[model samples]
Target: METKKGNFSNDNTMESIQKLTEQDAKTFLNLIYAILKDNEIPSEKLISQVLSVYEKKIPRLVKARQDNN
Candidate 1:
């Protein structure tokens, strides 16, 4: 993911979801969770954020993997 002028979108932020691999996804989630644990308290928003992060990380968890792995 290429960082833009402070915004995280478009060609900015992380690369498109298709670019992420399984280990990459797991690492991404771990990093986010680590940050959440260090800076934020447990809350619904936190949970939601975690889920959202997971949504990006493990796409298969949300949708069927066409590769059928």
Candidate 2:
């Protein structure tokens, strides 16, 4: 099987998840839940801020999943 590039693969997502602190991971889960449940768009700035924080703490794999989605 061919390995998928970019954010589409599970490997990337797992890497990101591994980098998050418990609190950060919780926040990320909540954010994703809210978006999916409410069909709302979070503020761009808020998303950017979260991403900035995650970029530093999270693994590239996890970041890739978030980026892909």
Candidates' C-alpha lDDT: 0.55, 0.55
- lDDT for model 2 comes to 0.55
Question: How many pairs collide in each candidate, listed in order?
Answer: 1, 3
Could you say which candidate leads in TM-score?
2
lDDT digits (tens) for residues 1-69 of candidate 1:
313543235442234455566876677768776858865556777776765564443454324443655
Candidate 2 per-residue lDDT over residues 1-69, each given as its tens digit: 114432224554455677666887888777656554653546775565455444433554355667777
Instruction: Candidate 2: list runs displaced more than 4 Å.
Output: 1-8, 39-69
The CA root-mean-square deviation of candidate 1, after full C-alpha superposition on the true structure, stands at 9.3
TM-score of each: 0.39, 0.43
lDDT of 1 at 15: 41
Which run of 10 residues does model 1 get worst, by summed lDDT? 5-14
